[model samples]
Target: MAINPDAVGTTGTPVESSWTSKDSLLYAVGIGAGTTDLAFTTENSMNIAQRAYPTQAVVLGDASGAFANIGTFNPAMLVHGEQAITLHRELPVQGSVVTTGEVTAVWDKGKGAVVEVTSRSVAPDGEPMFDKVMSVFIRGEGGFGGERGPSGSRSMPHEGSTPDLEVTLTTREDQALTYRLSGDRNPLHSDPSFAALAGFDRPILHGLCTYGFTGRALLQGLCEGDPARFRSMEGRFSSPVFPGESLTVRMWRDGAGAARFSTHGGDGRVVLDAGRVTFDPA
Candidate 1:
């Protein structure tokens, strides 16, 4: 069986997610925004900055309601593989914005299935603010009679159990509120009733926010805080992380360059698994 790209693109229902300024700044901090002693001070945070020229934003907007086969495929088997964000303009400190998301494409690589989504963030003024594409790969979800296609695959780390480096950080009770100021406000992370309706006990942290924090920690430990030496970072969100808790991140460096990462909760429960990141010599 072969997979239909057209069918894949149109299979899922469409969705609209909103955001705000606090969302972007919070996201910046989650990705290590503060610089030096200035990082935490009020004066430093008020300034909108980026590690580099490309300051893009990514969001974790789930479309569970529009899922094709909610039960058949294991969501656990899903792993975020690729992400790209484009900034249209500087995000305001606070306001409401909507992000419309749709299934962009899907590719089959014999070993797994890759699903891609394209999102458009628009301001209330109807001006397009940015465009983003997020992707996920489901391992062992292939050969379900779907046709294989061109795709990029991650090379697994060398065989063997290696001792990993772990770092844990505790988030403030209102961490989500702070993180959201960075530029995301999907309501699911801020509104309890909305979250409960979405199937979450309470508001949850953004997946990309966690990803950015993972990158920040990696850059600190592996790259010595040099952004240019960093090549790429990717991961999957196995579970939702609540605010006001300790997040423990474990790192497995394959060599002096590439590394694999994951994070667990203070309770030692895995929050993010199957995380892979890469870096280069400065």
Candidate 2:
């Protein structure tokens, strides 16, 4: 099905999901967490300890079979295009949460529509903890009469310029499989036939799963495994990366401890761009 131009930008079919603690920890493990280096960290350990520690938390929960929901867009024609996240209360350190997801923006991108879905995770005490923005690209599903006025994009902080620091993360061939153990059962990353139907040579990993891995790397490289010091992170998905690919993140540090980050494939094809990460006072 194709997107209704008249339906773009207007909110429809909002989905609200309430989840338990086990589901929350499952997403953490889904991103490759049980090892000492990764699990020992505060967030990972906290997710693991939740069975023991038990607090309040929330994670990515979609309101619709989002990709399949677009009227004129086929699931095979969709791709992860971008991600933006903001944390309000350090992610609950551990339990149960009610998540509300909604379509916030629909941008016309020639033959595609950039659908931005925003999910808000609220704790049981009525406190909002984290917010996530996921952008999915629907190829050949644009031009729905939406205004395509003058618009551009953000430049990478370390692009064509010197970077303050650089970090490389190597993904294992079984990475996606391991990450899936967390909670995501999307066959796009599991079944070969499903992946082929989606036009991929093999199933590709979830972009948010990658985001979680990047979060682990960034926390280790910059935050020193301190979740308390993490403020926010934003990045654009430049391309899809296969499992077992080595990812190198380039960061640009600015005055007063601000920084920007981007990652590329081994061949140096940019897979993520226009990324920025901020931290709390040290």
Q: Against the true structure, whose TM-score is highest?
A: 2
What global local distance difference test value does model 1 have? 0.60
Per-residue C-alpha lDDT of model 1 across residues 1-282, encoded as one tens digit per residue: 233445454434434555444454455565445545233212335573333312324543334432352224566466666555555554343444565566666666678777776666677677866566667777776655555655343333632455367666667667787667655667877899988986888898866666666666776777776555666555656677787767777788877787887777778776666666666765
Relative to the true structure, how large is the alpha-carbon lDDT of every model?
A: 0.60, 0.65
Mark the regions of model 1 whose C-alpha exceeds 4 Å error after superposition: 1-4, 7-26, 30-104, 107-114, 118-133, 136-164
TM-score of each: 0.58, 0.80
Cα lDDT tens digits, model 2, 1-282, are 557544434433434455555555555555555555543323435444442111112134444543333456676677777777777756543444556666666778787787777776667676876777777778887877676533547776457987667777777787788767655678999899998987899988777666766666666667766666776788877777788888888877765545788887778888777887777756
**Candidate 2 minimal-lDDT segment of 10 residues:** 50-59
Output the number of the lDDT-best candidate: 2
